[model samples]
Target: MAIQKQEFIERMKRLQASVRLSELEAFLVTAQDSIFYLTGVTYSPLERPFFILVRPDTGVVLLAPTLDRDHLASAPNVDEVRAYWDYPSPPGLGWSDGLLELVAGIRLLGVEPSLTQEIAQVISAWQPQAVPLIERLRLVKSADEVAMLRQAASYADLGMQKIIQAAYYGVSEIEIFSQGRAVQIQIIKETEFDPLNTSVLTAAWPARLGTQPHGVPSIADRLKDGPHIGLSFLRANGYAAECERTFFVTSPSQNMSEMFTLMLEARNRAFALIRPGVPCAEIDRAANGFLRQEGLGDYLLHRTGHGFGLGNHEGPWVAEGSPDVLEENMLISVEPGLYIPGLGGFRHSDTVLVTSDGYESLTRYPTEIEALTLLARRSMTRLRGALVRKAVGVA
Candidate 1:
């Protein structure tokens, strides 16, 4: 099971109990993601709103359109399912009225910020005296929650390895991307979590010969030479993981040999500093500090990394200005990238969990840039040989 029923009730209790919300008997949860976070039943990211009424002291009550009831019931930790009717079914004769009836005695109602205005207005009119409660109490994660995040991170690592394996001479960036999707699907299925979304490599070299790889060309663009660049955008169980590395289609350049070493070192520096109780901003500073000292500060692009779980990105940002403090169960990515404008960039990212003592690197894939460069070189050599054969045949 994704999450246990008792676990969800416990989570809900934790949420309400944290803020001394005993007076709030029922919380109106409209955010679908929160519903999944609390219920562990994530079907789809639909526009249709779902509601969960919880009386921290009591239990959970779910409301959605009639069509979604069966699937919602299948969710691991959900109970007391209710639904509203659409089409020819009578209007205003559904879960809305039941929801209103359910919370009759509740004076304090909790809601997420993303609640639709229409729902808010109706809710307010129904209970004019009820105070609205904000469910922003979900920032911190528990140990179990961190485990699921670690699982998702593992899937991402597998996907990267699959990309490396599929990369070879004459293969287009799109082909590598296809292989990545297959790997993502396989990993998610093994974990029994629904696949959210996946994006693989953009291994195109620039039109100019001898220039570094990372350029955002049109989809129709072709590699001027070899050394195809690889990028993958993957989401495992709705948690997003992005990774990119440059590969030589045949042979790695002399510069690539040195850049790969620096990339791996920078990644290691960031990983070693990640620990529970550390300030989130300091994580970025620590990683950036190393790059700056190496005189490669100008090559850095994005922040050190971002938190991951449930949704692709979440709390405890690994960027500057993030005052969020790391906790034992919080999961985040420790990625550092060196992107030179005209030259290609190199980056290594892995999802990690903060532990009681220190941290756990969920991903075990080797991010040593040299290995990837060598892989690129081998692929490029094969492509060059094939091209030469074709030309000779035509002549």
Candidate 2:
């Protein structure tokens, strides 16, 4: 389920209080995610600018494009919604006119750091301060947000399971990803989930391509007898979670097996350090330090993990040089990877919630090497995938 209206009301109230504390006559929120958090409203502004003006005493006002008026009718906690005719309207009917009218007498204004340069210049008269008030507030998840994240993580786990089952000899990566997406679609239909707010992305990086952590997948590429990275990154009901695993279609070489073990150990080390009041960097150091001691530090590519919420990747980054401290109710991923050039990549990611004591993993997919290694099974999926690829002329 999506967050209740009461939660959104409380969020707006908190933002107002923060604006008052900052001694700003008004604060402008330009980011879509921040707007959604303050008021239970979601819409893509495209080229049109959208703004939420939070005043210390005047309450919350939404300045949006006319196209979004009816769509945002049910949004809670918004005192007023003023609409502009369109993006490139005439002098008196444009977004700038409406914004200027709203903040005519405001002497002190604070705007979200995400405000575009165009908007910054338009509001330069106010000398707007770029404050991350809403971003900081989103670092910690509320009980409802945690529940949605847990539900999203469960879907991710299911997507991983489907990907593993669909991985067969000669089956293409797209075929395996398709099977995972099919299952998620079925769930969305069955539960009547909000289609716009939910998303499912399954990907496979096989053999050499796995070495490039962000490499794009090819439809022609087939899974082979080596280490493969399977990813299930999804969001359900406005909350996001990720589940990833490294699996082998057939038995792996000795070196591959050892590397997988080491990668898992690195992830566990990070997991052990997850608790309230812990520095995010410390968790990363624990895992990276262990890998460095084992002489595989050069293979470490990215941070241990990152936060998750309304957006796929948010604050409280688990990496060196991060200034964030772990707090209770923060949702984060614990993924430590080793990307060896010829051997392929070894990494596993799970969405975990930081609790008062330690942490709780929401994605409960099996991670054991034995569980990950799959035997070639005869299936029609291979034949079907090849025929579709040929028919579509996708080489």
Candidate 3:
């Protein structure tokens, strides 16, 4: 809801510059992320379609739903705002009708890659290449974007504090998530992170039954064992930061603790390699390579991390063979995790800011195994036992 005109001006200036250099008559955006980056207003891309047309000669032309007129009014640097009626063709106009009006005189136009095939059919003659200009521009964060990321990272860290408290023995995954989510909502509200924009809260954990990366959090899945971890993906004001921690209900089994230490070491190794000029792939190798060397490579689920901003998962991916190069002020998550079916997952993710000299960790939670260990609270539900072989405590 809070719109910054200066940010919008700066983005438009950069986009215009890119347009001039590329000889594009105009740049068009259809994806929510691309439109949000340029217009400072993000809408849910559900039934209704939205479009932002950026012309070098003209300012910005927005084709959006009439209901969002007030919201788009707050947007900075936007010139022409045309609100189409509801979807499914309302007699005279629809999304394609709006597009046809905009590109009537334009010779060449470049559009966001995410624009649907049906929408592209309206302007296919222009031959849009899904230009990398906007994506590349988004890779480097402005001062304000970095500031928002820090706030989002702090929000994630705040949630982890409560999640650790809630992950006691006999605590249901759902119970832990609910308590932690409540506290995090307050934190997000306090930070003034816009909930209407991107996913502004948290997707927390102790929600899973085992080591798999993807699992639904259920009340039936209770923590009774060695490692109870929570992964928090917190979005503050449309920008997101990833933070996660591994905690033990009781003392971790020797293997769990040792593997956790190794995971931390891997994360640290990736941290040390971050700088302005390094290739993104090297960061992945620094972390994943270590895990592979330790014989835990088979347990790896995802990349070392990826870029985060307006898009929850953006460009400059930190994965092996990635084509992106690290730059100052670009934020990435270096989460090096290892998971085994019966033992549960051990991954520590942090929002790392690629600084001028090196990297600064935005998510500053204690990683010490002892600090993460929690004592059992009163049982919330009667979970038979853990999917994990042994709970350090009685289930």
**Superposing every Cα of model 2 onto the true structure, what RMSD results?**
1.6
Best by lDDT: 2
Please give the CA lDDT of all the candidate structures: 0.62, 0.86, 0.76
Query: In angstroms, how far off is 101's CA in candidate 3?
Result: 1.8
**Candidate 1 C-alpha error for residue 379, in Å:** 8.0
- Candidate 1 lDDT over 172-246, as tens digits, reads 444444456566557656866565433333233432322343445443333433334455556655455555555
Clashes of each: 12, 0, 1
Runs in model 2 deviating more than 4 A are: 190-192, 387-391
Task: Estimate the TM-score of every prediction.
Answer: 0.75, 0.96, 0.89
- Please give the ranking of all candidate structures by lDDT, highest first, separated by commas: 2, 3, 1
Please give, for residues 1-395, the per-residue lDDT of candidate 2 as tens digits: 66888998888888888999999989999887888777777677789988888998886788888989877767788888899989899879999999998888899999998889999988899999999999888999999889888888988898898888778776686676576667577667655486666788888889878679899888778888789999999877678998999999889999999999999999888988899999999999999889999999889889999999988898989999999999999999998999998889999999999999999999999999999988857567567777756765765
- For candidate 1, the lDDT comes to 0.62
Q: What TM-score does structure 2 among the candidates reach?
A: 0.96
Top candidate by TM-score: 2
